[model samples]
Every structure is written in structure tokens, then in C-alpha cells.
Target: MSGSPPRRGSALAADRAEPRAVRTRERVVRALFDALAAAPLEELTVARLCRDAGVHRVTFYGHWPDIRTLAADVFAEEVDRLARVPEDVISEAAGPAELAAAYERALRDQLREILERRDVYRTLFASGSDAGFRRRLLAAQQERAEAAVTQLARAGAEVPGRASAYPAAFIAGGVVAAFEAWAVGGATGVEAAARAITAQLPGWWPR
Candidate 1:
């Protein structure tokens, strides 16, 4: 006869396991980020990552099927750090000017964080890197842009029908390009890049 399947665990055991799992994952993620910062992604391998993470090969595999999947998660987490803005900042804005001001302030804060992780941005956005990573980054930015446009419209800003989405797409692409340029040393500084991106928005707005 075949071996019996594993038995179910108690609720208390599962509760304890959850925090341990989280801690292990966090250690692995931090190690991955450190490794990426030290070398190009193309040079990275599962064995090296597991060693650097101080995690067993099985543990790493338990959390991620492969290095690429782990990489995508790292990229997404970094992108999210730059994309999230507090809702309360714009929630109370009374007009387009106020909303724009709130948006600019929020963007500046995000840009500061981006600059702090300049090395990661430069490596990830560099030419000849994985195309899939670029697509994921772009998709994340576009999602945020769409949400921002929707919020502006809900806040009484005049978003012209059918054409409203155009602004979001344009802004998202331009912002990403500008940041990439800045990260690669093509642009002067973070503040200048942020300003340049914000300046183009009014042109894209329905007028």
C-alpha cells in the first residue's frame, strides 16, 4: 500500500508557523535585494541567492519556485514603495489647484524614496535587462496613473469622456521614462525629474 497522506495540524501550531514563515521570507527577500545590489541579475543564481540569504535551498524553493519569480516579487515590492500615496492628502483638497498641489507633494515624497534606492532602480531599469521586468514595472505605474485619474475625476476635476485615460497613460509612461533616465545619470536630479514629469500633466489634461 502507498504511504498515507500527512495529517492536519492544530490551530496553535499553524499560528506559530505563520510568524516564522514571515520572518524567513523577509530574511530571504532582504538577502536577495542585497545580492542584486552587489551584482547584475544575469549573474545571479538560485544557489548563490540561497547561500547569501542564509536560507536552505528547500526553504527558498518553498517560498519561490525560481529566482525569476523571486525577482519579480522584489521588483514589484520596490515599485509599490514608490507608487503608494496617502489618500488623506488628496481627500480634503477643494479644487484642481489644491489637488495638484497635494499630488505634487505626494510625488516628491515618493521620488525621495526612489532616490534612496537609486542603485536598485539603475540596475533594474538598465538596458539589456529582462524585458519581463520592464513590463511589470510599466504595468504597475500605469495602474497607479489610472487610479490617480479616477480619483481626480471623482474629486470634481473635469476629466473629458473617452479621453480621460489618455492623460493617465501619457503621464505614467513619461514619469517612468524620466525616473529611469534620472536613475541612469542621464537626468540632473530627483527633484528636477519629478518637476519635469509634473509639468507635462497640465498639457495632457483636457482643455
Candidate 2:
């Protein structure tokens, strides 16, 4: 933030190269996107991300606790955008099936967007072997899921449970599982994958 050179950590050496600290961060994130596209997450490392972003190690550490966290932040915009559908919007639809269909449509639109940019999510998710990495990804998803469920309840959708947390957890779990499997090279068909999870909504959530 301070144009002052980054502290001498591996996260930021490359960032110091640039006069502006903000510019340095952008460079690092850009490099990460580039690297993950070409390889798997197992191959990605903090050193590599710093080098690719053209920043120093200090710069990276300054910005993220780990590469996985950074990757999640990179993909955060898309996730936030997709999760923006008003919660109550579900009730406008006639029934659970209609609501499920509508929800899936919105979800699919975003899922496709993420899938289309498969390299980033794939690479970030590929790092799922690490608990911290998976937690970061899952936490971000859970936040969005919770908010969406609240919105749905406000709109009049009957989430089976009296509270939002249960349904929210169930929905987030299903979606995250599907995406996680795909990231790890699971054989499930995309349509089938989406439907498999979406189909559960009619029964799993409040009808």
C-alpha cells in the first residue's frame, strides 16, 4: 500500500522491483493466473507465483497467507457476482421444482463461467490436498450459500429446516462437492453433475 518498497520477504521481492506497490500486487495475481492455466495446482508454489507475478516473496506474503488463499481471492469476484441473486427471488417461482430449476439456472450460469475459466479454479482447487487451501475455498462458498439461503427464505422458499444454517450447509456441501470432484478430474458428466446436485434440492431443502 505504501509506495515504499515491500519488506524483504519472498512474497514481495518482485513487487519491490516496481515503484508502485499496488502495481506489484496486480502483477503477482496476473502471474498466478498465467501459471495455473498451464499446469496443475500441485505444481504451483509460492516461489513460482512470486516469480510469475514479477514480484518479490515479500510482496506475495504481504498480500496472501498462501497461494491457495490468493487463488480464491482471484476467483472471488465471479463467485460474488453469481451469488448476488436476491434470496427471496426463489419464492417468486411457483413451487419447489420451479425454484430449484431457477436456482440451478443461475447457479449453472456461474458454474459455466467458472468452468470456462477452468484453469484458475482447477489449479486453485487442485491444491485441495491442503486443509488450509480447501478451507479457504469452502469458507468463501459457505458465506455465499448462507446469504443466498437467507434470501430464499425471505422470498418464501420453505427450507425444510426451521433455520437457514442447515439448508445452507446442505446446499453448499452439495455444490462444493460437485465442484471439488470436477477440479480433481472426476468422471461425472457436467450436466449430470449439475443435475445430480440440483435434483437433491427438491427433497433435501424445505419444500
Candidate 3:
């Protein structure tokens, strides 16, 4: 007889390995973030990152092929965290005022996260940095913004224009610019930045 099919949970556990491996991966990524904040990505080496993370070079290799891969993973994780905020903020049942309040809350969450990681974000997105990395990060944000627009549309909200995507892309670009300014200390504060982003959304949703 053929071998039995792998159990679902067992398959997942195998993919993730044990808790120790997960912790090590987290440490490696965190170390990369810390290291990148202090210097450019070109300056980082696997040996240095391994030393900083207190993990073996073999372990680092097991998790990622190179620093760029690790950087992509870190960006993906950051984007996923930001995406979760909108789920709590937008609801199908929310009225116009309620939706506005929720948008404010979500905007605050996004700005607060940027402030918390200001150094790292500035390092990654600063002009003359890694073009690929900046493009990936911005693309992720655009995807998130597009997803948010889809959610609003599904909730029976009236988005501007026959092409909802145009507004979404515009909003995403504005958000990126706002965060860049805030990251560089051009914006007055997190609240002000949040207000600016929140203002842009009002026209997209029925008020």
C-alpha cells in the first residue's frame, strides 16, 4: 500500500520546525534590522549578522540564501503587520462617521509603527539606497492600499471615479510620501501625519 498522507498539522509543524528554530529566525531578522539601521545594506555581511544575532552561519544559511532575501522577508513581515490594522479599522456595517473614525485609528497605527521604526525605514527607503528594496516596499504598500479599496467597495461604499484603482494608487503614493517625510523629521508629528492621510480618504468613502 502507498504511504499514508501526511497529517495537516504535522506537515505544518515540519515546515515551521520547532520553537527554537523559530526563535533563531526571529533573532536573525531582528539583528538584520538593527544592523541595517546603523549602516547600509552593502555594509552588512552574513558573518557579521550571524555574530550579531548569536546564531551560527549555517543556521543563517538554512533560513535565507543571502542578506537581500532576509531583507525581503523582513519587509514582508512589516507589511503583514501593517495590513492587520485595517481589518480592525474597516467594517462592512460601519456608517460614514464610524468609518472615518476607524480610518483615523488605522492611520494612527500605521504612523505609530513608522515612528517606532523610523531609523530602519529611513535607512531602507532613503534616496540612493537599494532601488530594488525600496521598490518592493512601496509595491507592498500599494498592494495593501488596493486591498483596502476592495474591502470598501465590497462594503457598498462609493469610491471615487469609475476606476477605483486610480484613487487607490493615488492614496498609496500619498501615504508613501507622508511616511517618507515623517521618517525624515519633515512632518510635525505622528498625529499630524495621520490627519493628513485620513483627510485623503474622506472623498473616497461616502460622507
Candidate 4:
């Protein structure tokens, strides 16, 4: 954990690039979700989704076992949307300061994303499409948590093997709560919550 991150472009590329398989997968997920907005998730059918995506039934079944699994996955992907910019926004970060600053920016971005995609979240959250709302939301939050871990780990913090996942989970829960308390009221405290959580990490911050 010393020199610059290994193949920054190559690594970052992996984050952005959607292989054909991934694109098809995401398209199917999105199609299913869009259909859910029109009706509840339970109403979605493989035949309808394939038609929406202009794909074939055989292809759909090749990728998904059943519509429920596909529905669960669609929700998972939707909730798990993440951005990878805050860490790069700041330059020579060190210790908690750097992490906190990036946290603030990222939190702000998250709110912006939520607000901008309000229609999407509202439809998804309101549709009560699937029984896996909480689970999918948790999964979504975990993606962000894991991204932060990668950033911090690259920054220099030695993540304790035993308690690694705990920090992210604790922090992500805090994030959602803050959004509920302040963001729900049309106020913005995302940055504040992010800073607070990042400060709680048990090691020096990374740049």
C-alpha cells in the first residue's frame, strides 16, 4: 500500500465499462424495472420484459432463472447505483482530513443523484414491487460502502481484516439515516453525515 494505485486507468475503466454481457444484463434489469413502474414487480413477466428489451425469451432465460430473481436483481442494481468521483476531487489527502473532505463531497453527490433520479427512486420505492425492498436497499448501500473501502485502502489506511465490513455497514446505515432526518425535510446534511462517519474510521485517512 505505497506507490500509486495499480493501473489507475485500467482499474477505473473496469468500473465504467459495461461489457456487452453486462450491458445486456443491465438493459434487461432496466426493462424489468421500467415495467415495474407501470405495474408492481409481481406483474412483470419474462415475455413482456423480453419484448420491451427487444431480446429473445431464450436469451432472457439464459440469463435469469425466473422473473422473481430477475426482479430481485433489478431492484438490487437500482439501489446499488454509485459514483466514483469524490475521492478524485481532492488532491493530496492524508489521514482523516482527506477522507472527511471526500466524504462530504461524495455525500453531496449522493443526494444530488437521489434528487435528480427522484422519479426513479420514487417509482421504485413506492411501487412496493418486490418483497426485497430492504434487502435490495442494503445491497445498494453496500456497493457504495465497498467503493469507499477501496478508496481508503488505496489512500493508505490499513483496514483491519476482522472488522473491515463493519465500518462500511455502520457508515452506510448512518448515511441513509441522515438522508431521512435532514434530506427528507428538504435540507441537506449528507456531507455532514459523511464527514462524521469517515472520521470514525479507526486509522489514518488516505489521500
Candidate 5:
């Protein structure tokens, strides 16, 4: 015999609730960014966030444990958005030198964007910022770097007789640290920061 029919009423209620949940999330994110524009994350409180978002404290707690968690979610989204390089530029590289140049260009572009929002990032990524946020941010960047390096290795990029993970980790860790330092130093000189990063890549890398 067939199983009993699904609960249509419950399913319908969930379906309707999803959009409202999404809207609430959007409002919270908007409020967080707006607040950050005027004040640092350290100064932001759950009460103020809920007030600005027009959400209740219970509603805010329903989504995140505290302000730092919500801030992490917001900054994570920004990091991912700024970290993505133009795929077409990478794909169209005619040789290793071109590919390296493309990578530098992409890095500079990303840095420029970050420099535009320097105050916000400087506060969020500073030494005094949330440790969990920094860890998650570094992990996300490392994961992306690992995947890219792995793909390059599969496509004939050199790795100095070691596995791709070695270079991936080195580059990811160095770049993240370099950028974090740059942010902590008042987020100046995008060109200098980008150059410092590109200079660290080993000769065996795609360059």
C-alpha cells in the first residue's frame, strides 16, 4: 500500500513562512550595514540592532545568538562578493605570464573595492574584532584558494614537486594575513598591498 498523503496544510504554512523569514533576514542585514556605517561593530548592541531593524529582541535572537554572529554573517557576504575575480579574464589568459597578470589585476580590483569600505573592514578585521569572525573569514578564503590551486595543478600549473595543498595554503594564509594587516593599518595603498601579496607567490606558482 502507498504511504499516507503528505500534510498539505503544514507544507503550505512553511512555504508561506519562508518568504517572511527571508525578508526578515534582509532587513537585519540592511540594518547592520547601516549601523556599521555610523558606528563600529564593537559599539553595536542587540537592542540597537533590533531597534534599527524594527525587529523584536526575541526575533533577533531567533536568528542569531548575538550581535557578533550577525556581524560575521554580514561581513562574510561582503568578503565573498569582493573576493570573486572576473572569470573571463582568467579564462582568456594566453599564457602563464598573462594568467599571473590577470591574477594581479583581479587582486588589485578587489583591494580597491575594499579600500572604498575601509573603515568598516578595518573595524571588523582588526586585532580586537571577533575571533570567530576572523577565523571563519580566513577559512573561507583558504577554501577558495585551495580549490583554485587544485584546478590549476590539474591544468599543468607547477607546484614545486609537492601537492597543490602546500602552495594553496601558503598563498591563502599569506594573502589573508597581508590584507588583514593592511586593514589594520588604516586600509591605505591598495597597490602596495596587492604588490606585497603577489610578490609572495613562489616562482613555481602560475607566474
Candidate 6:
């Protein structure tokens, strides 16, 4: 049986509301980035953010519980893009040399970003107040690691007998630890750190 058609007024109102909500979120994100340029994440308050966003406190709370959650939501996408492995790097058709070069380029890109944002990285790692953002960073890296491992296995790489999640988590955790150490200690340059981190990957990993 066919369902009754929807009310035109209600459908139009719903469509309008969605765009308005998107605009509100975009404004908030812009305000947050502007605030961060002048001050650290921990220093911004809901009242100030709402004021800068030109949004009511109730509207802000409706979108995010707090500023930390908003920051995590915003920065997580950047982390995902930085950490994601290229498809060719895990494709079976790619030779070892090609895979190795592509993988190294991707790793170096992530490391360079870390170097560029070392101050923000250090703040996220060191401050308890920024734990949500740190967790978001770890989660994003873990997702990419899992994708790479899964794709590599499908491409004939020998994965461990245990669940794939275990190895992926280990790899992601190690990368996060390496970043934290580098940000906090400034022990090695980006190239050295990238090489060191890549060296620790499992033998079965592509390159």
C-alpha cells in the first residue's frame, strides 16, 4: 500500500530548519577558530563564544554540550585528512617500491603537520582540559590505521592471528605517543621522527 503524501508546509519548514541549523554551526565554528587564533582552547568560555558567534547560549548548547566537544568535532576532520592512508598504498596492483614511496610521503605529510602545529599539539597533549580533543585525535588516527590494515590484509598482506582491531589500536596508540613525545620534547626533526615511527610498523604493513 502507498503511504500518504507528506504535508508541503511541514516538508518546507523542515528543509528550511536544516539549512538554518547548518548556518548556525558554521558561524560557531568560525567564531571558535577566530577565538583560538588569539587565545588557547582552554581560555574560551561559552558566553564569549556565543557572543562572538552572534548566537544565543541556548542555541549554542543545542548544538554542542561545551566548547571542548565543538573543538573536537572541528579538529577531528583535519586529523582524519592528515592521517588517512592513500588507496594506492594498499592496492595489490602497486609494487613494493611504489607502495613504500607513497606510504612514506603520507607519513611525512602527517609529521610535517605535527611539526607545524607543535604548540597546539603540546597543549592538547599536556593539558587535562583538552582531553576531549586529544581523544578525538587518537580516534581519528585509529580509524585510519584500521582502514589501512584492513585494506592491506585484503591486498594479501599477512595480518596477525588476533583481531585486526588490536593491531590497529596498537599502531594508532604508538603514533599518538610518538607525536606527544615529539611535541613535548622536541627531540628530533620531522624527517627523523617520521623515519623512526615508520620503522616501528609491523613487517606485514605495506612498506
Prediction RMSDs, each to the true structure: 6.3, 5.9, 6.8, 10.8, 6.7, 7.2
Which candidate ranks first by lDDT, i.e. highest?
A: 6
CA lDDT of each prediction against the hidden true structure? 0.67, 0.64, 0.66, 0.58, 0.69, 0.71
**Full-model lDDT, candidate 4:** 0.58
Q: What total of clashing residue pairs does each candidate reach? A: 0, 24, 0, 3, 0, 0
Per-residue lDDT tens digits for candidate 5, residues 120-173, read 666667634443567767777777677667556555677664464676677778
**Candidate 1, overall lDDT?**
0.67
TM-score between candidate 5 and the true structure: 0.77
Candidates ranked, most accurate by lDDT first: 6, 5, 1, 3, 2, 4
- Candidate 2 local Cα displacement, residue 46, angstroms: 4.1
Residue 116 lDDT in model 6?
A: 69
| lDDT (Cα, tens digit) per residue for candidate 1, span 1-207 | 669653221111123258877787778788877886788666778799888878887776666666665676566557656677677766777765677666676667667755776666666676334434566667778888787777777776776652556767777788777667666775446677777777777543432
Model 3 clash tally?
0
Residue 100, model 4: lDDT of 55
Ranking by TM-score: 5, 6, 1, 3, 2, 4
Please give the lDDT score for candidate 5.
0.69
Best by TM-score: 5
TM-score of 6: 0.75
Model 1, residue 78: C-alpha shift (Å): 2.1
What local lDDT does model 4 show for residue 182?
37
Clashing pairs for model 5 are none
Q: Please report, as a residue range, the 10-residue window in candidate 5 with the lowest summed lDDT.
A: 7-16
Identify the superior model by TM-score, candidate 4 or candidate 6: 6
Q: What C-alpha lDDT, on a 0 to 100 scale, does residue 98 get in candidate 6?
A: 51
